[model samples]
Target: MRLNQPRIKPLSPEGLTPEQAEILAPLGGGGVIPAGPVLNIFRTMAHAPKALKAFLTWGNYILSRKNDLPPREREIVILRTGFLCKSGYEWTQHVEIGLRCGLTQDEIVMLKTGPDAGWSPADAALIRAADELNADYFISDATWAALLTYFSEKQAMDVVFTAGQYTQVSMMLNSFGVQLDSGQTLDPDLRKA
Candidate 1:
């Protein structure tokens, strides 16, 4: 919603080059990839096979349980980062993912109120981490301390990485003007961005 039109048009399924197809084949194998429609993120990224390949490697780790943050905690960071970055595509996609990961609709809505929304201390810490990272590019000592009280070193690191990765994704999706996939409704806040 940030741009009226895409800066670079997303590729259609028929438009993929063989090299792009080779790099993207694994996406189909993962249950994470939806069967009916390929997301515009994938279609657009396929334009650069090498970059897309490298992106998928880090992305897989972040989405996988190997990242140390539990799924709900991870979605907290992702949804907040996506919102802070004003990325409709990222936010909309994550809303679905967040629900499956155990975030209730009320909790997801409260993320917009940020770290001070009367959430459990641990959840507030996660939101504050994202907000601080988005605003300062570094977490403040207070937020870092709060985070340490509840998170292991690995989980803390995952928080930073998740925020950073999603920030980049937001930038890409916004600049690219990647539209929402079918059935996705843009959050009103994102629409106004």
Candidate 2:
């Protein structure tokens, strides 16, 4: 939605090179890949197979239990970062993931207003961390302290890395013009932003 057209078009699975096909093979029908359009982000990233492969490693860790943050908490940071970055693609994709992670529709909407949107103290801390990381590239002492009260060192580290990772992802999706997958809807706030 940020751009009318994609700068880098998505690659179709049928058109993949042998090496790219091998890289994507594990992501097919019953592999670790999520059930949706594989050509969305993956196709675009396939232009650089090594980068995409490395990205998947870190991405899997972040979404896996190794990150320490609960799914809901992780979604809070992701949605907030996506919103702050004004990334329609990331925002649209994460809205569904967030809901599955236990965030309510209202909570999802409230993310656009940021940490001051009447979230619990802990949730607000997570959002504030995203905002700070986006705007300042560093978390403030107060935000860091608040986060310390609720998250372990690993969770705190995951919070920073997750925000940074998605921030990078937003830049990629926006710059490359990654569109929403099938059945995904763009948030009104994303459209306006």
Residues 72-190, model 1: lDDT tens digits: 99999999999999999999999988998999999999999998898999999999999999998999999889999999988999999999999999999998898887788888888
Rate residue 22 of model 2 by lDDT.
80
The TM-score of predicted model 1 comes to 0.95
TM-score of each: 0.95, 0.94
Residue 96 lDDT (model 1): 88
Deviating ranges (above 4 Å) for candidate 2: 29-33
For candidate 1, the lDDT comes to 0.89
Clashing pairs in 1: none
Candidate 1: 10-residue stretch with minimal lDDT:
28-37
* RMSD (CA, Å), each prediction: 1.3, 1.7
The TM-score measured for candidate 2 stands at: 0.94
